[model samples]
Target chain A: MKLFFLLTIFFSFVPILYAQVDTTTLQNNLYDILEDATTDKEGVEYYDLVEYLVQNKIAVNTASIAELMKIPNIDRQSAIAIVRQRNLLGGIKNENDLRSAEGVSEELIDRIISYLIFGDVKDVSFFDSINKNFKAIDFTLRSRGIYDLQQDKAFSDGKYYGSSWKIYNRFVVSKDKNIRVGVLIEKDPGEKSFNDFTTFHFYARDIGFIKNFVAGDFLFEFGHGLTLWSRYSISKGIETVGILPRNGKGIIPYLSSDENMSLRGAAVQFSFNNFNFYTFYSVRNLDGSIDKSTNQITSIRLDGLHRDSSEVAHQRIVNEKLLGISADYSFGEIGSVGLLYYNSTFENDFQHNSLLDPSGNSFDYFAGSYSFTFGKLYFSGETAYNKISLATINSAEIAVDKNFSLLFSYRNYPYDYWSLHSNGFGEKDGTQNESGFYSGFKWRTSYGNIYFYYDQFKYPIGDEKLPLAIKGNEFLIYYSVKPFRDTEFRLRYTNQLKESVAAINGEYGVLSRRKDNLRTELLYKLSKFIQMRSRIELVKTYATAISSEEKGLLLFQDVKYAPTASLSFSGRIVFFQTDSYDSRVYEFENDLTGVMSNPALYGDGMRWYLVARYNTSFGLSLSMKYSELIKPNEKTMGSGDTLINRNVDNRLSFQLDFKF
Target chain B: MNLTIYQLYFWLGADLKFVKDLVFSAAVKKEIGFNPSIRLGTEYSMVDFFKLRIGTSNEPNTYSGGIGIIYQFVQVDYAFFSHPDLGLTHQFGLIIRFTKN
Candidate 1:
């Protein structure tokens, strides 16, 4: 039954899958930065900000500090220095002028220059621009389909309601810089309805006193995300020092195809003088498994798949309500301070099946944060308190010299602290019982740029494996150098040691494992149209109880060809060998322009992918991607519903973009 | 024969520039799979600086899209894909290129 349902949904969308485009490596560099910050569990949310900056090219000469801060890698101190330098030199005449700013490092300037334009801001007003151009109203449509070759249980048993294809579509309408309205629909394999999931939103920004407003669906981030952050938060990454401080944009419209993790209703922001205020309310239906006898929610379904009868039965079993308010005060060039409060209530109480589960139907959170900069030193911190516990995070960044910088951060989150929407700075998702201290430094020498950090953390109540309180420490060192124009080299090494519970002599005992990772990459622009990248990575794991050590190795070659502005293609071939999943290696891949794919290669395999994009004209673009993994020793691939019949697993995807 | 899965997608789009720097665009897309879905979207770019985008689709019946900025060699795209029965997904992408002549 479930297989039939899945097939029905898959076949329904098959007619439109022809002539789809291939993926492109347009944002490979950005993904490189984000991939460093991502973990196996948490997602990344910086894509929107990068897109905004790309389309609205920041006018470096006239941009405000806030605008400068929107660019990645630009810290508060760097923004201030850029503004001061611009004022002192009358204005930035070119990228070179901005690069010479005090407190600005060569690496920072190189990272931000592409997103900025050194010129006067456009003279046309938002309304005037739209009025003069009837084309100022834009529309876009996109569709994607994915299918697996291997037949799973649902497929073999004919339990899927839809075909094996996963179909997705999106439509949008907008008025330049004024109003936007959008809709999205998707159906996964084995799902019953062609449009099993749908979303709509209308948003407006930068009009009169209303800074921004969203109706339908939206997300917000405030302070360090301890109180109200409805999206992914960076816990740790290669940037090492600069990303410790959270830069929250009060309220923004939500736009994505993810089936979970946002609010429905309305949100609005207003500004008066140096003070800005935002408030939002949302009521949303969530998928979850419920205890029939207790009338309580046993587990929430975040994957948003309803292919089978049991999954469909669990759909929309819980109703959630959220309310939040925030106020921020900016003190000109000195810094800013903000306060946030959020409350969430569920229709059904969350019944705790395990000690780690949170109970009750309502949860409230309060938090405050402040950031200040004085010359070459900057400080920022946030403290959040919930009904049961408190979480605090603080950081200090200092520019020791033009060639060196240092960053330090401390976080303490009590075990009982609970915030459903909190994604604070911690080793795990959400701000719960975890405490850590981190310090990092960056140095730019004539040979290369060096970055390193050390973090020490502990869990008070123990985790899934360790039945007793556990302590862990991690350290990373990274070095990068541009040997020549359009050529670069990078090396990184990381070591992590953590405690876990293990069975010893038929008795449970605490054991610690030390994992070390080393990676080296080289990128070269062979020509104006051809580029190549090569990487080699190694991982080793040593258990305290066992004398033997496990090791893993991965090597890959990447090539990109962009013969013309209208067409480009990239491909990667990877070979990996590992003793076990414990020694797995993670590598980021080039996917669709907006999509990110970084699969962890384990159990010895050969993986490869090809992505290509073609812009037929100024208004039409198409992209497609094909990827496959082969593990000769393994008979079954994947787990659960995604399991494949053979040792080889593969997928194909295509997308199209039309502007005019 | 090797086990193979074939997927297909179709899209139609149009863009108009009424002013020197202002532009408008619209598009429709469809995909075939176990469940077929259709999407519609429109966007407006003001003075080649900022762009606002809106879109809707039927399958799960969700609304999504975002705003973006395109300047010279850099483009920043932000999107919000939401689902009525589920939650929302927000994504941001940045692209930088040094075109060689």
Candidate 2:
């Protein structure tokens, strides 16, 4: 037994080692963001798109950890290291200088270097900067195709009219910071035409007075998002410290494949001194179901699916027109105030299905926003009015000390408050009928770093399903530590107590529900060329005191190997089991460069996938992935048109990217 | 949901015997999740079918020892492992020969 005692003693003191940057961890998170964007819905507002801000970039030397996170992929650790390194060297000149920082790798620097503007250049004319750096238009093209090996009920039953292949293609032409032209095309499975959904835009920036100009299709994000926000806004999650405040980046070019929710027309922003003025107008068709007998539109479908006859018949049947104008002025140091007013008109009147449903063909909104920074504290807020209702949110962040930070946010959006483009921060999307208070803190201790947040919200006016006003609260605790240079560990636990409308044992009405989640993960490097990760998670959902709790468990192992300079492999094996759908766990897999899939796993099954990437001497790359799921207990894979009448399900995906 | 974890170990082992009554076994293990560890063990025969074994491995590491005995029709082996944090563990093995003529 002497050998066992010796082994135990050696591993005990490992936690005292100094921490270093984990290049693989950074690369993996960056990959996950791009992949999730491929099929991303409104979740987290696609804030993790892993792209730089369109036209607004903060100065690197003066940027805080919160501001630097705007570039995605840059976690709190990396940001802190950068700030520390910059302090030592006074300033950074280029990516190579970043090497002095702990935890940074050459491969990582190569990817994020472009997102950083070394030693911010100030007092230069827009024309001068553009003239000095402008080059020939850089062109990029990407095309992808996906297929399912097993036939689904939708195609087998002839309910879908087209092939089962999903096709997507996009291209962008950009010249420095001067101009960008982009077009995207997508056709989901069972869609009839190749160009069923199309989006294109031409954006110009950094001109004399025209701060930004856009034609065709584009997105607008400003202020707290109550009045207008369309793209890349994060919601409440593990990153509680930085999520409460949204640093508006103004108008951004749209290129993703999201079919709807984009303004199509012309917009321009004129800036003079510290004052900026904006004007925008858009007209677009929406997929809506109409009540033929009354000529009234009943519903606006946002799914963007056109497969069946009824779905195809309602495609682009309703027209929506929008007009808006706004102005903002910079005040004191690190502060600004702005106002916005907009009007919307629909071609047809909406059918009054419920009292909360928006009726009539025209609506108007007015809003005001402000952001101020004092010493080490930051504050921001916005309030909007829509004739009958009002919505507002106020938030603050304070750096109590070098080791402690705190954040607080409060929002109240009455049920009647309605804004078509409101992607604000609240318990629910659209920021309606929600009132909540969120308090979070980030603390760095000698043992590790701790992040905690508690959010309490309630629906003053519930929807049809939930007829009564209900209150809920959610709390999250996250802890992370890296004892060794190449080793890291993370643990998170989140618990939510909410009331929902559900039928348990014939009891309907509001039922109390509780959801608790716990996850632990480990990442370390085996050698210079290989990295590995292991994770395990548990989920539990208790409907009520009288009902039993639903439990779920998931475990996965990952391996990343780069044996050669031009080729690499990433693979994972997952095992998951859940009591029911309510407790199912969602897992995001590493797809090709621009592809990602987050699928909910249930039942007793094992899933695995391997992705291989190869880069040639030229500007061409190839990636392929093969994934399969085996459920020993289930007879079918899904339900409705998506059901696969087999125990095993699999798919093949391919993508090609080229640049010149 | 991509991340990192630390403190796990994967191990590889091999045994080499150079002399008539002596045998040596060694393992080289890497802890992708923790730290590197190595365990060295050796066995010496006391009689025709009796042997004694001892080994040690190390930081919050371990120590182990075992013995094996073989008589005409049956053989039994026992081993023990000890660690600072893991306490102690005992393992046993048995073998019986079956033949018909």
The TM-score leader among the candidates is 1
lDDT (C-alpha) at residue A519 in model 2: 84
Cα lDDT listed for each candidate: 0.75, 0.73
DockQ of 2: 0.04
Q: Where in model 2 is the C-alpha error above 4 Å?
A: A1-27, A31-49, A52-91, A94-114, A119-135, A504-507, B1-101
Q: Which portions of model 1 show Cα errors greater than 4 Å?
A: A1-26, A37-45, A122-132, A353-355, A464-467, A503-506, A546-548, B1-101
Q: Each candidate's DockQ score against the native complex?
A: 0.01, 0.04
- Model 1, position A547, has a per-residue lDDT of 58
Q: Model 2, A1-660: lDDT tens per residue?
A: 011111111222342111122233334655433332322343322432343252235567766554564564443345556877888898877666787676443433555564677776553445665577555558888888888888889899989888888888988887665677888888988998989999898888768899889998877776789878874454566666756677555676777766777889988989887788999999999899889998888988877889889889989998999999998887635677889999999999888777567888898989999877776777889999999888999988886665677889999998888777888887667778889999998787778788899999999766576567888999999888876767777898989899877666676677788999898776778788777776767899998856869988776767777777777788776767788888888777766765546778877666778877777778787877878887755678889888988877888888887878
Candidate 2 chain A weakest ten by summed lDDT? A1-10
